[model samples]
Target: MPAPERIPPGRVSSVDLLAKGELTVRGRVREASNAVLYCSVSYEGEQAHCVYKPVAGERPLWDFPDGTLAQREVAAYELSEATGWGLVPPTVLRDGPYGQGMVQLWIEADPSESLLALVEDEEPGEGWKAVGFAEVGEGRTALLVHADDVRLRRLAVLDAVINNGDRKGGHLLPTADGNLYAIDHGVTFNVDDKLRTLLWGWAGEPLPADASRTLTELAATLTEGAPLATRLAELLTSAEVEALRGRVGVLLGAGVHPLPSGEWPAIPWPPV
Candidate 1:
């Protein structure tokens, strides 16, 4: 498949506008386990309403260290930017209403369209595939689906490179303009193999040429003496960064989509 067209970055300066922006809490998103609040962030006469997750409000997890998820979110954005895929929303770590944490641009999605419903449709839409089935009640069922869009396929490759451990269906947001913004990347960049996603639709398929080239470039940038690696060091441990570099090498060697290891889950719980 041809490479997804690379969207040129705007004439605007490359600034962490949201991070430096004045943030005010509009309301809390009760659905999140941690304190994720919706807020209006204003900076340099520009204003945007976005999600804010304060480090002080973070709920501890045994698998991940405390006060680090916020940093991991930023790290995810950094990796996304380096990939030039524009798959993740603009995110940064900054001091917010409560304390220091993550702030991300809010994606405006078509609420009328639901991924769950589309996946469970008796006849699935074009460019989409059913990965597995979900048991509802006796004899009742639902299907888990993922898009075949090149951007999404690239994102699946990106998830593997970052060791993303939790990629739930609800984390995908399709904007009104057909852009897909992936969010909630707090559990990422582990030194171990923790990839858990719902994007195995193309498993075992050869990695597209464009995807392979991009991964190759990313692998180069992640090596010692590279600027991207320097930036990653500030967000992740040395070991974790090395692990990321290792995954890049592994992906380059495999040259094909990965299948479930069966040692760990291939999908997230509460998939949607």
Candidate 2:
């Protein structure tokens, strides 16, 4: 990834920069399933790097409605902001050169931060939580584990609330400033129970105190006619919005991390 061009001194907010700036296609992230254009957005000479995913470039998904992935991405960002966790970067839906799509602040992850690991031991040692077992080829198996850090725990709760269908290792972004952000939310907010991810280490565990409180607050904000509810209505179907509310209620009622539903695959293929 190339460094973003520096902007003259300014104080524009990231959301403002993304929503109003002129986008210049700097490059493309070819590894992404959907069209991911790496670009720089400049507003009044204040420039910053961002990712642009045009709705026209989205691929069809049998499970999700067509042309709605970009909206879902923005919806995920809204939910993340409502949680006060800021786990997802600043994202907005706006008209781009290719058409309307999702634009989000581009973050550079720290190369040295190790959040997931595979170990030969049956159980994970200190500072780690075991997810399950994975085949490492040659008929060998290893324990899939993730860090026991609170940041990841909070993200797990957020995932449950949104019913994220793909929480692969690549989506976890940890920066050098001690901030962790998650991305690629196009498959989230489905009405069905499709919470697939590698962060199942906390399954069946009691919800952390902070998480419980946040869920309680989120439930209130998601009630019918509320601001968040109204905003989500624009992005998701009525059924999906209702399901999101029900999910929060369920979390508050259950008071623990949810275990995977056998109805769907517990982990996404190519987990990393």
Candidate 3:
């Protein structure tokens, strides 16, 4: 088998890292049922601890094709880089453990922060935006949460841009560096109106100026024959890519955050 791909440790595009690197499987991530492994990669005297998800181990989904989730994860990283938000840690796809899989730099997060509790605050605290409330059975206190942190706000916009179908709370991690990383994007970029997420806190609100600019840039990147378009062509279906572009245009035109269309459930189950 061709050796695993690797890249410079800290400062390269996901494309660069994924395109080059020698991968070595270190161990398995026992917490997951679908095989996830810990890996180490190195190239050019640079090394990184990474997570690798081999295509051979992915569980089949009725709604999504088999062996394609790894590619979607890479696509999400690519989109994150295109937006210049640095919200997704560098990710790439290459040969690994069992076969070709998605590989990404492992971000260690602060143990101090609990995004769930932060959002569950009853009051709309500073730096937070409350979405709504849910009842717990009959007499139990209703559950409430507000998506807090400007980083989450950015992710909300990105989720919309990708037509992300799963943005569960556990997918978010607050790094020790104080930066937030959004992970587990294997189910994103569907060619449908499926932006279910836990980030509806800013629903219908105006987009942040910078977020709008990023969307505009992304639209340009999706134009025919653009670099991003070319890369995406390798991973996503043509229809899905077109849908991504259309969604960007829609967001730009609306100039505000989107509200649930009610065509599907707006949130994922077991939110955190």
Candidate 4:
């Protein structure tokens, strides 16, 4: 494996280190469950909330080298940046005496929110509204419907192409200004059969026009050897790309949808 990317420690400044608390208990906005520490940090001189994943003495569900996962995460963020997804960005992947971890831009938690909150909130001027469907009592519920259904459908197609196996409610972050963000991609782009997630409840539905356009754009960019594709090729194999393409085709095909029959391990209980 390649050496983990190095980010300067203390680069964020002391004022940003707000508090170290139990994220789950405190109800902080967390992108992953592996490790959590809440803090305030300055990103580009702007006061930003941040989370630190301590590398030391923590356990991950997978057995990948701590260093490699951090590097892959950094790479994933870089890809997101290149795609102009605004979902995630390149973060500080770091290593210390404790082991290896990452420092990511923190998203504020919605105070009066639940997964259903997105649907109720109105779109703000020039802001992205984070909206998705939630599984409610064996049926699908629209969580946030601020954006046009077309845009949401396109994002769903993108998720399929990425084979994102963990598109849970917590992964969706909506800025008060209206921008929706997706995080926690460590489990994606792997050369394995782990493409499971909760967002595929509407599998057989026709691809919304916006989604078809986005997929066409992504496919064209990949065929033309976009830098993002070059990077993905490094992490994923030809077969993986083919599978992604196949998934896209399936989503676009007539009367095709994801059929949920058995319980999946990756899906959290009482999927939010």
Candidate 5:
């Protein structure tokens, strides 16, 4: 593993640290599909852990253009910020050990947080929402469910807007401070309908007041010359940006959570 470079003592923000600091690869997240590097960044004596996904390491997907996943991940962060939801950790696009990539602040998940679970009963019970049934092993199946959490609900809305292709349970991070952050958004923002996720609990339900309001504000922010629209233009194609705006408009018009279109698999493989 490479070591972080030494720097003088000074204070800088997390985003600045990730962007300007010396990035040293501490290890690899072996379970990740892409080259997810666990790295330490230091600038002016400020340090933080982050996940770096170099564009070169991204595997070519038939649906998405080559070398665009990193930018898509950054785009997801931008949309999350625009929603004022703070659902995504601080993220930036910058050069790293391998090359330019998406660098995002790492968040430690609280082990005790019970956000998702498998239940034997048909119903998800109070305070929980059913995703569907899943095969556990040995021909037995269990009900997969997630918390009817306000935070997770907001994330579902964000996922819908981003056309997130993958929103597995493992991507959710619940910190000790009770903050929930979602990660691994590289498979997002496709021009096609790819909003696969485990957050279908609220599907077809009426949109929450806060979510409706956020979508309304987001629609205005996505206007041609708006700041959010301008930033997205840099990361995504014009058609993709237009699709995003269209999704938001559809959500606003529906006034309810969207149901899966059934054109493709509604949930990701390996739900966790």
Candidate 6:
């Protein structure tokens, strides 16, 4: 395994300084027990929108400190870039008088057409039912009916290999054109049993053809001599890479409809 890519550190420009006067506040995007996310109009002309995440004031149930959380978020973005998956884009981590926060690319919110909305509009079929998760609203089920979709399923597998603990329904955004995008990957790459998530509801199922191909390509990209492999090695240890490889092998062996276990929580709360 090679070293993971290093993200450059910098301070985000002061929002207060930028917003001299008459800056209208956009509607709140999300507010949860751990963090509050807001969309705001930028003072500068270059960027129109920015997403803000304030520091967690109280001690969290999870073990990550503020700095570690910020670093993980940055690392996840870098990995997403390397993998060509729109999991999360580049973000600016900032520390100010208010405390720590992250300024990321603002995703345009559609007219309540997210994946969660789609699930809420339909009834759960034979293999679907709502799980006790915050993001799964009323009438929404967590089961993956199109589990056979190779691209989507493979992305899920990659997520699992990364030990992403937050794969909530809300984090999965469906574009107007029907492409799915993943967001909020703060609780990942930890060396612990904290691999909780809502995906893998269909474990042991056969991998879709396209998913297998993507995984194969991803594995090749992570080989010893590859740039991606070198980048990952810097960010992760040899043991972590071995674990990731093991997860990939398991997913490749499993098909598209394996059952999920009930031991772990369906998703990570306060998704950062």
lDDT of 1 by residue, 64-135 (tens): 888999999999999999989888988888887788989887777667655444345764578776677777
Q: Relative to the true structure, how large is the alpha-carbon lDDT of every model?
A: 0.81, 0.94, 0.81, 0.50, 0.92, 0.52
Tens digits of lDDT, candidate 2, 119-155: 9999999999999999999999999999999999999
Residue 41 error for model 5, in Å?
0.5
Q: What value does the lDDT take at residue 128 in candidate 2?
A: 99
Among all candidates shown, the one with the greatest lDDT? 2
Pairs with backbone N, CA or C atoms under 3 Å apart (clashes), candidate 3: 4-22, 4-23, 5-21, 5-22, 6-20, 6-21, 6-22
Quick one: best TM-score, which candidate?
2
Candidate scoring better on lDDT of 2 and 4: 2
Candidate 3 structure quality by residue, lDDT tens digits, 186-261: 8888887888988998899899999988888889989989999999999999998898888999999999999998
Q: Model 2: what TM-score? A: 0.97
User: Which should have the higher TM-score, number 1 or number 4?
Assistant: 1
Question: What value does the lDDT take at residue 123 in candidate 5?
Answer: 94
lDDT ranking of the models: 2, 5, 1, 3, 6, 4
Give the alpha carbon lDDT tens digit for every residue of 212-251 in model 4: 6555565555652777667666655566555655665655
lDDT of 3: 0.81
Off by over 4 Å in 4: 1-32, 39-47, 54-68, 75-83, 89-100, 117-154, 233-266
Clashes of each: 0, 0, 7, 12, 0, 21
User: Model 5, 40-67: lDDT tens per residue?
Assistant: 9888867878889999999999999999
Per-model root-mean-square deviation over C-alphas: 5.2, 1.3, 4.0, 9.1, 2.8, 8.8
Prediction 1 TM-score vs. true: 0.90
lDDT by residue for model 6 (1-272), tens: 11212222334343332232122335445444445455444333323454455555323644554445544555566556655665564555565324665555555444455233124334444434333333456765443332333445645665766777677656665555555656666666766535655554446556667667766677777667688767666556666556666666655666453344455664555432
